[model samples]
Target: MSKLVLSELTLSHFRSHKRATVALDGRPIAIFGPNGAGKTNLLEAVSLLSPGRGMRRAGADDLTRRPEALGWKITAILGSLHQTHELETWAEAGNPRQLRIDGKAAPQVALGRIARILWLVPSMDRLWIEGAEGRRRFLDRATLSFEPTHADAVLSYEKAMRERNRLLKDMVRDPHWYSAIEAQMAEAGATIQRNRQDTIVQLMAAQNAAPTAFPTANLTLTSPDPIPDDLQMALADNRGRDMAAGRTLIGPHRADLDAVFAEKGTLARDCSTGEQKALLISLILANGRALARDFGAPPILLLDEVAAHLDATRRAALYDEIDALGAQAFMSGTGPELFSELDDRAQYIEVTETDRESVVMQRTSL
Candidate 1:
């Protein structure tokens, strides 16, 4: 089976880099640079290859090169088999972002179908302990990787919920209006919930089958609302509370995924910081393994500052698992020492900033 590889990268008017291009070899890429050296920005550019916001979750306007001076563009050569394909993403001088594959315009969501991507950022370090929104997003990102259509269900569910909220606030008490919106919500919500359950099942199976130092987690969906097996009945039942609260409080939107360290019987949030990080790493590896087996090609992995939180042993283990899966992983760090163990097996890149301009150079061993 052929694998996906990024053969070349070019960026202009994006973040701290004014103009830069680097030819890449087919190996895990290790990028080292100081803070604010635009290390994470490179990862963010890679993330745009998939759907939704990049790693930083910045808006299209924010991504426009600072000083409001110029537009932004990112182009990359993606190789699979013996053929190469081009993907370019750009935002106008002061307009919304757009994407094109092979010079043909396409929807942003279309990217996920062509290239699945999964990532872990430094901000997600306390995901389990924080609000459910972030954890839900994390789960959805994983879900989207496995099932790109999940994006449609999420969009539909959110749209319907928004309308219902507006109706509640406006006191548009028409049962007919409620009927239509609730129907849409129920259909989309059920599908959304099912997708998440399926993704968790796949991850669980993968984790159970894989061997790694990363701690394992047991995941479950928790919500006060009973996700009805029957959509119509669910809508009718929750209508009273919905009207009173002026919000659709029961459905996929309310569901939260709970994770616990299975062996230790520890709540993910209650676990030590290191344990929590380990659990996240375990899940990410499990995700990669699952995708590799299901899709024949593992999804591209983005680990922003992944090495900073782990000890030497765990960091090495992470690399080992990634190698075994044959996935293309882009990991960022502050120096070569952080990736010393992966020296021979992975490609290396050095990032630096001088005179407020960023440059990326590929490193090779003699």
Candidate 2:
């Protein structure tokens, strides 16, 4: 079985927490607290364990605890296979962030090989109806879970595209300048497209195979400009028009994800509101299963206000599925009753703001 457990969590000047340490047992964790009690901050800190930004994508300054705070630090003990690994992420007074593994400095991407984190925030409630950016980000997060190197490909592709756009706007007709950049973009673009395609394939397979309460999503990669199999040819074909428009218009950058209710054959946006939320949850679970099969472990999951959106039956089913998968899922909500179905198979924590400081306590053992 694959498992990632948190034995200890320490926070200093993190959000509303001035200083705190919470010991955890081996089980899924459920956090309950009122609004603005800094419940989500705890999850955000855990999400930082993986690559890219945290769940909220807040800036460094935004994470610092309220008045009189300098910076924040989080230390976690990740356990697996009778072994333990210590990880820490911190930002100093008005300084850039830093990550430490076993007391040694490491790159952000390196964290992926050691730990994988995935999340579903309350803001995502509008995912289907909102713009494509959130959905695209959601897809990329799933992409990164299976293939950590997808991060580098994304970075490389975006950098080259930026330079290509600059050249276009400058009216630099010299093929020499644009050629090298376009070549870089083409190489990375092909890799990006392939990774996304492979991830979707894995998700679809998992959705078909999974037996759960959530509804399956028929997922596809959509694009206004068709992504040609031949990268060089595609780039060459779009060069003139791209130069005129001041941007490369025919690459992975313009791609969007299309999702539908597999059973009803209704588009995600057209589905009922409740059905849309179910589809999103189904896709996230499918992403986790796919990663588990491909990487030998499921990514750590963060579900913010998850219980609020899910009915009792679906909530019980989700809990059962997550327990069976042996995934370490951290779920947040307003009350402990939402997690009642977990019974003795989960951990419970209470988050609240008190006496000008934030607190996270292991209130009960599930």
C-alpha lDDT score of every prediction, in listed order = 0.86, 0.85
TM-scores for every candidate against the unseen true structure: 0.96, 0.96
Put down candidate 1 lDDT per residue, 1-366, tens digits, no spaces. 567678888888888888888787767889898998998888888899888888788887787667755889999998754457799999887688999998999998878667867899999998988898888898998899898889899999899889889988787766888888888888998899899999999999999997788888999988876677886567777677777898877788888989999999999999998999999989998998888787667778899999967999989999988888887889999988999988789988889998788878888841
Q: List the residue pairs that clash in candidate 2.
A: 344-366
TM-score of 1: 0.96
Candidate RMSDs in order: 1.5, 1.5
User: Which stretches of candidate 1 lie above 4 Å from their native place?
Assistant: 81-83
Ten-residue stretch with the least lDDT total in model 1: 60-69
lDDT of 2 by residue, 1-366 (tens): 566677888888988888888787757889998888888888888898888779988777788887865988889998754468899998877887899988899999988887777899988888888887788788888899888999899999999889888988998887888778878988998999999999899999999997878888888899987888887677876778988887888888888999989889999999887888888888888888887777777778899998866789999999998987788889999888899999889888898888977777887664
**How good is model 2 by TM-score?**
0.96
Superposed Cα deviation of residue 237, candidate 2 (Å): 2.9
Clash totals for all candidate models: 0, 1
